[model samples]
Target: MSARNAMAAMLDELMGPKRNVELGKDTKVTFDDPDICKYYIVGFCPHDMFVNTKADLGACPRVHDDNLRLEYPKSDKFEKLGFEREFLKFLSRLDEDNQRRIRKNLEKLKANEENGQKKEDLRKLRDEQEIARIDGEIKLCMAEAEKAGEEGLVTKCQELVDKIEQLEKQKTAVEERLNNTATIPPPIDESAIKVMEVCEVCGSMLIKNDAQCRVEEHLSGKMHMGFSKIKVTIEELRFDNGSRGHLLMLLDISVNVKDGDHVNETDHVIEIGEGGLDRVHEIAIVAEVVRATDIVGMIVIGVTGTETIATDDIVAK
Candidate 1:
């Protein structure tokens, strides 16, 4: 049921014919006697007698004064009506005071918020001003140096220029460090050169390639030579008879020897061997390529302007 209906039913039940105590004349009652007057006032029984004794019904007694009896003839029958009127009057007094305090507190809170925003704006403006001041100071320093015609002034400008260059280099280095990481290739097994015994009489080192010095029991008998290997991705492989097949093959690749034993290549392709049994052809396989980005390290070749081969026919030459 709704609260209004529930309350009305409860009031009807209390003031119903059962406990028949009606006020026909102005009655004298005390807040202390809650047991007799409890149901008439609050529509409930006092659960705890101790709490009932401590509780005070702080209603204005002026409304219940006997001298005011001639005003309302029905007031004598409803003493609760007078108590409620006096309670509303008490609340009105507090409501006025609360309104003034609420306005003052709200204003103070708004002022503090605006002040904080102002401080933040001022801080941002100061930062801008500081940057402009530094620029201005640099220009003024340069102008003064030019006017004075002193050699030390030019040196001071050079120092500042060097510092700026260092800062620029540091920025570029940091950017690159963030962008890339070094990847070392896993090591492969290889034989090392044997070490020769010293000539006993002269304490001279012997050549490792000599027959007598090429012993496994020597201190450095195994020599490892690290060479770059290339894997060829071939689209069509043809033999002397014109038989064609697709192949993927890896060969030990090297640069073509030049004047000072330096390897040189303008493109990725490499012709590995001459017309002999031990000869082999090695080709560099490009992994990927982009039109705009600069290639770094060994260029990654991809299937650009090139055909891809089938996988099954690769042979070790």
Candidate 2:
């Protein structure tokens, strides 16, 4: 929607209950009414995604009429509603914001990982020092036992030997504790509470490689669902815009297949349009040349040039 249109819609939607009555008395309802949410008309509204959650995009200030939404796709004004462009712009901003959040979250996780390792190292160091102290005490006791034995004090020497044995057992206990810290199991990053990471799309906390069930549960959650819907809708809107409201199976332009590079056979063609087959359009979304063969229902033609496709290779049902 245009800026002027959006402003007018916001004003009208925010009108007081009394003003709404007055407008109804003086105006008529139309699908193109400024108060209707264009995003909703296009498909799903982003505002509905995070209700009751931290990412909640509070209530939308515009009207969301189901009737209008249903009628929009079939409306004569469907082509270039401008709302689709606006929707794409809005989604792009959200995507950028989410990306920033992911970066920030990763920094936190990195810090947490460092702190966790430091804590473990410190613990192991303390344990090793305690064992060294015990060893030093045992060495002194052993020397005393040797001197006592040489002086013909058998009882004192036996006592020193028993004391050294107790110290050795105590040292063994500390060594076991140290070994536990150096084990292979993944330790909890107490700084982060427990291996927490950010969800790239929703910016919410997720356990790194969490249990499959928990992962599924998170994906199905309202916040994730909301962001996922926005992403899919944005893709559809871009596709519609590029194909001019027609669902055209265009080549994935990003592949960048060079000329005569052995165009590989496809399992299935990649489609990117949303229109019915009734529309009189017939261009295969493929590379600049050498289109898909055996198009059973439509004429397949090269989009970039009039490259010769075999007459017998294409048939229309």
Candidate 3:
């Protein structure tokens, strides 16, 4: 059985049937030992593998039982409205101050939506008034055309009629949109938190909070800060243009490398220089070029290695 299932089985055997409990509240459970994972109390335990491996007792059984009973917050109802789990997790990770800020932002979003609806109603009213005015103009033009018996007056009356029809069609479309907006719930703005940044090291998009909890969590994450000692080297080499002058070079070498042919093949090896240096560094094919026109006869490459490649170093393949 998998470690997760095994743990579940163990919990069932120890705690009877799984029952709900209110989270963030003290539970009545008796334990002989005091060494327990605090994260397990809230139901997020990252060291489950260690427990299955018998490296340690994992999380205290009582804590796990208590977590299973912990009640989810009422705001979690947003999940039913199609709010993503990540968004829910983001909200939970926020401190009390940030949570209040998020609530305020949600109110603002609703207010903005209401204001927009008012503007749309006003615009629709104006369109209706314009349509009424156009109808009067068309009637006047038609009477003038009949009195004068002129082709020019008749054409002017026809143009006025067409303009009124167009206005009516536009007003109908606006009315439909407004009705739909009133009936359907608006989508929650993911960017309502306001403070957001992309991690430079891993390119992970992170949202910030007033308490800086999210930012600190992201920066301290193992995936984000794990490669601190790793370095990449890229060598740029320029070849003579032959007869096309310096502007038209035969080859433009960059540190970045991409191989379209072996994109799906994970076992392929990339060799650098004529010497066939095997264990160079990490090579990632960030993008695939299906058309030759995209590269313009020049290869694009990005390299990550032990040492930073300098412009003076000549890298040949």
Candidate 2 residue-wise lDDT, 44-121, digit = tens:
778877779876777676787676678777887774455765666777777677777779888988897899799879
lDDT by residue (1-317, candidate 1, tens digit) is 46776554455344432233555743434332322332224221112211312222232111122222333234433333333223223333333333444455556555755775686567556545655555565666556655544656666667666655554565455444434423212236322123333422112234447665443333332110000000010111111111100111111122232332222354323222322222112122211111211323222212212332221112111
The residue-by-residue lDDT of candidate 3 on 174-242, one tens digit each, is: 456555655434449846434454444444545544358767776676544432211110011112212
**In terms of TM-score, how similar is model 2 to the real structure?**
0.63
Sort by TM-score, top down from the best: 2, 1, 3
Point out the worst 10-residue segment of candidate 2 by lDDT.
248-257
Off by over 4 Å in 3: 1-94, 150-317
Each model's TM-score? Answer: 0.27, 0.63, 0.24
Locate the minimum summed-lDDT window of 10 residues in model 1: 224-233
Clashes of each: 8, 6, 13
Best by TM-score: 2
Candidate 2 achieves a global lDDT of: 0.63
All-Cα superposition RMSD per candidate: 44.9, 9.8, 21.6
Residue 253 accuracy (lDDT) in model 2: 24
